[model samples]
Target: MTAKPTANTRTIGSHFTRAGKYAVLSFQAALTIFPIIWVLSNSFRTTDQILTSIRLVPEQFALDNYLNVWRMTSIPRALVNSLTIDIVSILLLLAVVLPLSFVIARFRFRAATVIYLFFSLAVLVPMVTVLPMTFKLFSELGLLGHKYAIAFIYVAEQLPLSVFLMVMFMRTIPSELDEAAIMDGCSILDLFRHVIIPLSRNGIVTIVILSFVAIWNDYLTALVVLSRQADKTLSVVLGYARNEYAVDYGMMSAAIIFAIAPMILIYILVKNRLIKGMAMGAVKG
Candidate 1:
């Protein structure tokens, strides 16, 4: 028989395995974090310094880039527009999806499977597939220059994944609680508001973050759908700003930072719940 490992040998092996995991995780964290640190540093440095220096940290820092971007670019206007679109898109998404997801999860219906499968397919359809169609449709409908119209597009794009996750997460909530609420003389809408929405908070937050990021970063929809220079979203404005600033690395970097700031802030706010929602296997079939 092969020798059974002694206590000392097993202890060392366990420690070695643990150390390996730590090392790998630390390296992965560095890879993820280094670029953010470098971008932040460069955002504070001049173009010449950025081009010449291979350093992650800047020798000197300045806010001139931010000031120039704020003054020159329509970032402030675009920021407001994007914020408005995101808010509208998210609210609409929640209103439609949460109730639909509750219906799909709580009550068995003939079309539920078909509808869920339809959304699953939608999740797989790339945004580019409908770009031409959307462009033509928006143009035909005289919606080309409309800013809020983008909110509808964002909602449609986000609906599939949001519905999928919310349905799955809602399924994880005990049906007994739902039954209890219904038996307590609660109406269906009241049951949904007090039972489903409260229990599905994690999934709600998760989908909000995902939807916001996708909508905020989407350049093609903004480019194709919203034709007005005055009404473009922040992503499209960033493109114009990049072109205008062409080799001005500092301003470009600052604009990029502005693009990502909202995502970072939202992440910080909901990170714990997001992690718990994702990692706890909350979205189960």
Candidate 2:
């Protein structure tokens, strides 16, 4: 009883749908890229030009921003401090969280739900609320302004989320693997090393990437704990940039670009594994 669409009509409908999607996608892409493009363009412009001009491109490209940021600021030290905190915190998170998560996921215990609830509640408590007390404790311990001390705090703050992620991932891994390993005379440590850790590489990598990014970008905790200028992380250093010098837009842009470069490179390298890990966890859980 219904008339079929003519070829021309069908072609027009298809074209419109395609055009609509492309238009939406193009806008989203532009929104995402615009800031980065603006920063890069401004990084090559002089301070006067940046203040006076709204143009996206500089009339004359200059490398002085990069040179000035490197020479004037403690950017190199900040970068190193950020990296050290990120690496140490992540390693500590892995060392502590992995085994505990494995046990919690694999075993049934009377206090399991209670323990899980405790950790879940910890995540709800914001760092800002706890920082005052924590800073006092760190001061009492004489650990304030130390990179390792900051790393420890990062690990503690990050643990709940890391444990939750690892537990969920470990649960998805079959108990049969553990039983088989045991039958072959594998100890708990051996089983974890050989069977569990190997299979959970994707999840581990995802955790590593996420944790690193969080720690690297963290400003509040670092500012609170690292009062020493020499020990300040990249995020903290960037915050103090204006006070440290006359806010050179070009140099500021250059520092911002440098700060984000490592995270961008990491995302590019591990994006596939990260996607796969999330998919696997979501599907299995």
Candidate 3:
């Protein structure tokens, strides 16, 4: 037999649990922020100063490292390459995945289960496992140095997960909405464009943000596919910069900042929308 706890004991246990939760959150916040602060501080100091200094704050601040990183590296071209790939790939994913996911979620076709199973299996296949075959296929297709090829690959790579997520989110929408649209004499295309697309806005936004971040940070695929210095993505170019700069922490830090800033800024701007979308999807799902 189990006994019910007294008010005093319950209150004490709740207090201790709250304290533990707060302690964990504080520790996590510090772990995430400290490295970023340290890097930002070191970016203002010289390579030698960074090596010798033990303090987080720099005695002197200068922009020379940033200037050198911009002028000396192919980062500018890499930025252009990354943006092009990310934008085009995301657009392509939306074009294909949205409609298919809607169909899978709303319809009762015999092949729907089979199709969903196919994409689900794709999610389980590790991307790295096919790098050799991917490289050879792209090379043979004469797309090794083209930005569009990378964009194509990104769309294909991201499609499975994005479609799966959309399907899951779409299922949580009320079926009555579909019935009402159809009763109003809406055609299949009209129903999709007007009812389904608008209703799935939150899920769509979630996929866009996730895909953007994933493509922006991808390095291995870009490196293997884009061999030319002028065509490499930001991550690939950063690797080259690291090799060239070697132990120069100041320039390295600046390069890291440059590579990461665009994505961070994008996230900051859309974070509110992202959080709302995720929360709504979670509750609906």
Candidate 2 matches the true fold with a TM-score of 0.87
Q: Residue 3 of model 1: what lDDT?
A: 52
For the record, the alpha-carbon RMSD of candidate 2 to the native fold, in angstroms, is 3.1
Q: Give the per-residue lDDT digits (tens) of candidate 1, residues 1-285.
A: 245567778999999999999999999999999988888888899899998886688877889888988988888789988888888888998888898899999997899999888866756678899888988888889887777887878888877778878888899999899889888999999999987898898788888877777687789888888878788889888878756877898888888888889889977987786565545433432
On the 0 to 100 scale, the lDDT of residue 70 in model 1 is: 90
- Across 90-200, the per-residue lDDT of candidate 3 in tens digits comes to 999999999999999999899999998887675666778887898899989998867677877788788777887899879989999989999999998998999899989
Which of candidates 1 and 3 reaches a greater TM-score?
A: 3
Each candidate's lDDT (Cα)? 0.83, 0.84, 0.84
> Candidate 1 or 2, higher TM-score?
2
Off by over 4 Å in 2: 1-18, 272-285
Model 1 bad stretches (over 4 Å): 1-28, 272-285
Q: Model 2 misses residue 124 by how many Å?
A: 1.5
Q: Is candidate 1 or candidate 3 better by lDDT?
A: 3
Error of 1 at 38 (Å): 2.4
Tell me each candidate's RMSD, in Å, in order. Answer: 3.6, 3.1, 4.2
Compare the candidates by TM-score and give the number of the best one.
Answer: 2
Please report how far candidate 3 places residue 138 from its true position, in Å: 1.3
